[model samples]
Target chain A: MRASSRTPLTTRLWAFGVWSVVIFFVLNLLGLIGSVVTSSFATRWLGTWFPAGFTWKWYFAAWDEFQLGDVLWVTFEVVGWVVVISGLLGVPAAYALARREFPGKRFVVLLLLLPLLVPSVTYGIPLATVLYKVGFGGSLVGVILANLVPTVPFVVLVMIPFIEQIDPRIESAARVFGANTFKVFVYVLVPILMPGVLAALLLVLVRTIAMFELTFLVAGPGSQTLVVALYYAVFAAGVRAVQSIDAMAVVYMVTTLIWLIIALRFVNPTQIVARAKRDTSH
Target chain B: MTDRGPTLTQRLRARGLDGVTLLVLPCVLAIIALFIYPFLYGLWLSFQPKDGTTMGNYDRFFREPFLYKTIWTTLKISIPVTILNLLLAVPIAFRVRLMKHQRLLTTILVLPITLGTVLVAEGMLFYFGPQGWFSRTVMALGLMDHAPSITHGYWGVFLSLLITGFPFTFLLTLSYVTGIEPALEQAAATLGAGPAARFREIFLPLLLPGLAITFCLSFVQAYSVLPSAILVGDPANTTRVISIAAYQAAFEDYDYSLASAIAMIMGAVQLVVVAAILGARTLVYRGPVAAAKG
Candidate 1:
């Protein structure tokens, strides 16, 4: 390579600018989160770079005051049900889409995409309206049902690419060995599909937990998720210690961060973005 | 001899194997019952009037100018955020391609998004509030005696949206940038193409479609901002987006019909924007890889 081919000074400066932006972005995020973590533990932090003192009492206060025990339990219940139910319904549909060919298949796929393509509030208000009409609105059932609309399709779409990667001959070979359809799916298919299924379900678990719009719209007095509860804790017409609210935010951050880390183990972040596109558009 | 008719067991197995209805009926039923039915129901409800007149909710929405102001409010925030994300994302995404630890950097960047909008907003309040370090630092620097508040106006909500949106757009752009074969850049370099020239000629064409789609997706995501706007912005209506309007129309006012109408309008605007972007997408030349795959 010729030294004359070196990057020009302006190009070097431009590259420097780009790197600075990256550093700034990282520092900004760390500052935001670090401040919250610090504040949550601070005894008193009034306009200082470092907190005056650190304590753990705010966590206990946030716990008892926010009824976090119940909120966590409800979040788990909602996420668990949505994950399991979407898996049960979605895996088979994905299997069929991966393996079968039939009329109007593209149409069915498009129908599935509708729930995901349209913003949740667009469909959420209507869905909640029907749930309220049916005496299910503001209930845990409504939240679960509402979340399932987007999640089930998500499972089906994410699973489709995974399922398509497996050779169809394996299932056919099982059938040739006198195995029934159920046996082929249970013994032959499940082992091969386990990784994909885990990935899909884990991602679904993360999504359901972080999903705010649908849950917020349908959740009732007794059915508030952690996110909705945190929203109220911050915005509800009452004065509360900032540290306590920050504590609750930390809890949310940790919970979702854990799930997302687990999800990243099985899937590339870009693949997730790509999946969103393929799942929605064609 | 006449061919023997298929037996019941054979018929059942056949149905299980290839019967689309048997295989797909449950999911189809679920989508219809849960998704389609509700959307249609919302549509019907939007049109229904409590006073027994059609279009009443829409009429009321149109009659009150303050109610429809949310459209302008949402667009003002969403458009700028989308533009800012694209501008920052393109440069950062290009630089990231040069980094060896691209995946780790990406993961670190995307970590905040996993926290979701609510936590991010709450964190922003403490970190960017009047008495927060940002304000305090500026005060300490003697720029002003009083600390400036970022968590109580358009700037607060805009920053939150930026925080949430930047990583998403960056991730999408990175994928698209990396999807372009490095061999192309190397070839351009060997041919004496400078960085800018190579990017303009080789990368820009390839990245445009993906960027369009990314912009649309990110814009839609930002446009539907509710929690951040309400949590961090001037709640007196500075950042009162359309979604907030819909929420209030239903829950606070007990006017589900009006709420549904506002939601319908929001959906329409979003759809129009998305459709236009997608339409523009068709005009751009998709490369051989995309074309062959499609």
Candidate 2:
């Protein structure tokens, strides 16, 4: 692919233009994030290129003011349940969809895709209302259940390709060797499917952490995730120091960034797109 | 073998519904309870207004300019953002697909996804606000006489959408662009096709369908601009998106029926756009390309 020496001037110029845009975007992005990080540690920042002074007060202030410890705990609990539950429900469904030919399979695929294709907010309001009616709204359990609406389908979709790529003969071989369904799943399938399962759940972890709409609609005072809490902080802006808000923002960034880095190790970003293409093309 | 009755699993397997297929039942049931049931309930609720009249909520929605106009407001922001993201992503993805080390650049591009819309909005408030560094820098460099008010308004929400949506669109586009065989382009080059010809004739055709899908997905993301729209935008006026309208109806007014009606409208609009794009895709090239590698 490195035929740069013989490449035409126009091609090189086009490449340069594209890279220029990318660099400009990356720089601005870094600058934006840098501004938040800097302000978080700043003692005072107002109409200046640099803060007048730097301090750690805002971190403590934000931690205390936002009750971030509780928020973080809630966030962790919701994300953990979402990841584990979605995996248990979605992986088996994915395996079935990949291996079996059954009636209404296309309909089942469409049903799964509907939650994903529809924007969350469209479903979230009604779902929140229903949860409220069922008396689960405004709590951690409601948040977890609300989030699963999307994540479960997401897990199913992501795992199908992984399950499909595994040769069915392996499962058949295990069956022929007198391994029962449960035994094959435990001994044979789990080990083989571990990587895909890990990747899916990790991506789910990242997504649930960042998921705003569903959680926002369903969460109560004590049930807010970090992202939703950040929203409320930014919403009621003047009640807190700007620096403190920035500190909270930075904390949210770090939380998701950590998982994002780990998720990248397991799953390529392009594979997400590849999966989307495969799902849509059919 | 005949002496023993068929096992339960064996009986199920004969009916094309084996024990394995039953594994799917839990997920299907959960989706029905959480997603589908609520959707149907919402549909029913929309018809049963406080006034006890079917279509009352939708009627109220269309009658009120503040409520109905949100559809237009949402489309205004989402359509343009989706188009702009696609326009930027295609060229960049095309360029990146040829590079040896694509991972680093893609990773950098996708960083904003983890930051979520709230952080992006917060960052934009500081970076693009009147007193923000971007304005301060531009003024210091004499690029402009005064700092631009890019945040807390229409453009603020637009920029936020662009910043967050671009990475997703680019990643998807890159996957599609990479899926096409490089050999096809080399073959075109061998046939005396220039760079522009190769792209126009070869890449563009293969990319159209994927681009359409990318447009729909990205558009949906932008369409549901709730947090950023409220934080970065003038939600009372210019950037009152449909999601915000539904949110206000449900929470502030304690009106679930109206909220559900608005939600239904939002879903319908998105479905129309997605269906239209997918339908247009059928008019374009339709063939098996090699799956994405690396």
Candidate 3:
């Protein structure tokens, strides 16, 4: 307060510096993505500020050449099953963990944390090994199961705080009215917990769709997700058009970005990370 | 008519293993069978002898300098990314938190995370390659006579890592920064603490622990770099991270034991860094609650 004379000068300088950084960051992001978008439609981009000409031919070529029809279908199937199964297993577990107290609770919480905290690749190799040994690794079932390792725990952790926020007295009131266990859960708990459930499932869907390491290991020709397919298009032996590969990358980006936007509507990404941190630090 | 005996469900409920506990059973079973079993199986596989009675895989990894160099390569990329990300994130988070339109800024920053590492890497090839706009612009600006190919070397991969890593590190730092009650800073200012004084006396001490935590988490993430390294960098070895080594060992070499051994070592290194950071975090002077109240 006493330094009012200096405040104006410092604030002006500070604002200038801050906006510079913001503009720089945004431009860098735009440049990288913009190049891909422009090239995907470019007839030719050699030594030009913009493409020589634009066309939608590359999109069609990419779709046909990459068999993205099957890949997209497989991606949907894997993401869908993973979302449903993770929810089915995770929501109930979150409820139990939230509403009830038991011995070894700390240990159980740590068990849940391990999958999330560690990198997926660390466990993915072994998981893939075991899956292949059992004749499941190269199929859709393997990809879904492998993804569930991290995602199910993600659902449980995200749902726990939501479940905990609800007052236990609501359930007790339902119980006192002679509603049985099943009735109390469905008629009373589900309505109140719907928001949390939706948030958990949506985030799980985004994560499964984007999950790379585990999915990469277990996925085969018939089971490749969009991400794995994109990897192959980039690295696998081939002399494909640069524009076509960029087109596929664009497809993957658009697919993931759409779900992420939807998920953000349900919950802030900050809250999800912060809550998980808080849960673990305990 | 008088069959009023307690049913099986009621009996189970009478014990603490009620419906709630049963709710937890599927998760527990799945974790054990899928997560725990596979991890243990991998560990066992890592020890299998090619001949009959030797720890051959572990020995091979240590004996082959090429295989062991991956640890250093992983650290080389991870440490710089971690440090640079923090340096960039802290200042940006401070400034961004002050903005009235933080939601928009956060969305702009977080958009890349949705585009996974693979897409980001693929985009880098087009954006940073020799004939790409970046190089063309540099040449046009007379910065160089020709467009130096940046996308096929260490710099290219590093640039991509920054693109992906910055957003994540920034998000974590933003949450931590925002969590600190603004009122505390205001109170310090009212007490005649100048800007520097307020930062040093009030903010720095509190932010240190949080910064350490962020560093550890971010480092763990960067340390696991895989796809970008392979796709963009000279995979003949320049950017071959441990994950890539492990992957090639298993798939290309068909040496399952060797791959498992590399993976285990990778986990060990990550755990060591994490533990050390956690220890340092606990040593700092901490308040009753570090996070800002919701």
Candidate 4:
């Protein structure tokens, strides 16, 4: 409308065409997400949409009054160990499944996928009791182990298609020329496995961070994750009755959003599938 | 690259060991121990009683009115979320093909799935919390006079589930949509079928298998939702899903056998649902013959 009296209609539509949908969804999605943070610390329920004003009381209320940091650390600790142990355990298992074959191969593959079909509670109840007898009951370590029902299966599933694409023929040729097994893995498999490994790592990290039911069921009060903490915050403290409670809710949203954006930026889903045998045919 | 001196027999043994099943040994055991063994444990425990060796736990789960209602609630929440998700997903997947910025659009759509139910629950707090924007905006717009509390009760749980689940159904359908060849659409157009007709006759048929698989995945996802339901559902409404009951029975009540029985009941329900869906799906579409290649 501004550039010329007779601007090209096709050009105008072209510029706005794709942006139309994105702008619409993005604005609304962000608006809803932002509302959580903004409302968490309002001085009053004053604005039509936003808090009439803001306050730091909720942050202090959560940070110092409620002493949320310790529970937060416990959450981090469980997820951290989960990430390290599952990645170390899952990546190699994925490699073996993807590249190696023998008797019961298909059955073994199906067995690995069986957890996805099984509900977490189906195993959680029994595992919690087993942990009790083993002396890990209600402990953070118990939560970590219990959580593997979902984490390991997820890592393995994400990693299977990725690990498959590693050509053993290269490792074979290297061995034929005198490269040892460790050298072959380090030089050949590691570089190729990096992207799949990264994608799997990020996925594992995010999932572990968000894990609630397993941790809540297995861990002591001292070991609750942020999600469990937040749940109790609302469930126990009554979030609806308070004004500053919005801030704590905001804190949850911001942390999650930051984590999600970082994960999406660095992690590649195609890497999980593309990792199977590097498209040598193409 | 390094040399190790070995006897003649050792060198021969090393070559033969290349085909050994050593690598799979631990992971296979891990799967069996964590997965297969637990279900077996649940089965065994489900049959045990507080004072006697019997199938009392299963009997109790079936007979208890509370347990029965919990099962019904799980189905209530899971089914609606599944259907609404399918409707939203199909349209988005269809549109993805025609979009120019498909990468960015898909990234935004698919990215939410990684957040899982916990994050979705937390996200909903800010989005639907009394002070959050949606409630605020809707109220300001005279949609209501005050912030409509959404996340603390039954409807809150349902909405959180919808947001979290939409992406799972969408991504699966998108992959299926992309798998369909462009030439089929061209053929339909040449045959004089309109856009809707082509989608119905060719695309929908090809997509049914993918859609069913997506629905099952989403259904299970919705069915297993514990974190969100715990955060959002009103206990008064009896929105406590089966997962919460399992936790309560095991941890709070200190009744592992009874908890295991409830878990078995949950698994049994899931299996029956799957069986019914598979039977109905196969009978209606003759699907496996068509989608076996996929």
Poorest lDDT segment (10 consecutive residues) of candidate 2 chain A: A273-282
Give each model's whole-structure lDDT: 0.84, 0.90, 0.83, 0.70
DockQ of each: 0.55, 0.67, 0.55, 0.39
Writing each residue's lDDT as its tens digit, candidate 1 over A1-282 gives 467367567877888888888888788889889998998999998756788999999999999999999999999999999999999889889888877766678898999888877888888888888999999998999999999998899888988888787888887889899999788878998899888889888878888888899999999878999999999998872588988988998898888888888899987776555563332231
Proportion of native contacts in model 3?
0.60
Q: Which residues of candidate 3, in runs, are more than 4 Å off?
A: A1-15, A271-282, B1-17, B290-294
- lDDT tens digits, residue span A1-282, model 3: 667666678776876887797687788788889888888999988766788999999999999999999999999999999999998999999998987776666777788888877778888998999999999988999999999998888888888877887889998999999999899989999999888889888878877887888999998889999999999889972589889998888898899889888888977776534454333231
- Of candidate 4 chain B, the 10-residue stretch with the lowest lDDT total is B285-294
For candidate 3 chain A, the 10 contiguous residues with the lowest summed lDDT are A273-282
User: Which candidate wins on TM-score?
Assistant: 2
- State each candidate's chain A TM-score: 0.93, 0.94, 0.92, 0.80
Please give, for residues B1-294, the per-residue lDDT of candidate 2 as tens digits: 367888887887876797788889999999999999999999999998999889899889899999999999999999999999999999998788778998898888878876779899999998998878789888999999988988879999999999999998999888887778778889998999987889899888778877898999899999999999999999999999999999999999999999999999999999998998898887776775444232
Residue-by-residue lDDT tens digits, candidate 2, A54-170: 899999999999999999999999999999999999999999999998898999999999998899999999999999999999989999999999999999998898888788899
- Model 1 C-alpha lDDT per residue in residues B1-294, reported as the tens digit of each score: 797899776775555546433566788789999988887888888888687799788888778878878888899999899999999999888888888877888888777666788888888887787867677777888998887867878999899999988888889888778777688889998999988899888888777788888988788779989889999998568898889899888889888888888889999999998888878877776555463121
Q: lDDT tens string, model 4, B226-263?
A: 87787667754557888888878887787888888888
Better of 3 and 4 by lDDT: 3
| Residue B59 miss distance in model 3 (angstroms) | 1.8
Q: Evaluate chain B of model 4: give its TM-score.
A: 0.88
Runs of candidate 2 with Cα error greater than 4 angstroms are: A1-6, A272-282, B1-15, B286-294
Fnat measured on candidate 1: 0.62
User: What C-alpha root-mean-square deviation, in Å, does candidate 3 show against the real structure?
Assistant: 3.8
lDDT of 4 by residue, A46-121 (tens): 5454457777776777676446678667767887898887887777777767765555677877887677776666
Residue B275 lDDT in model 3? 88
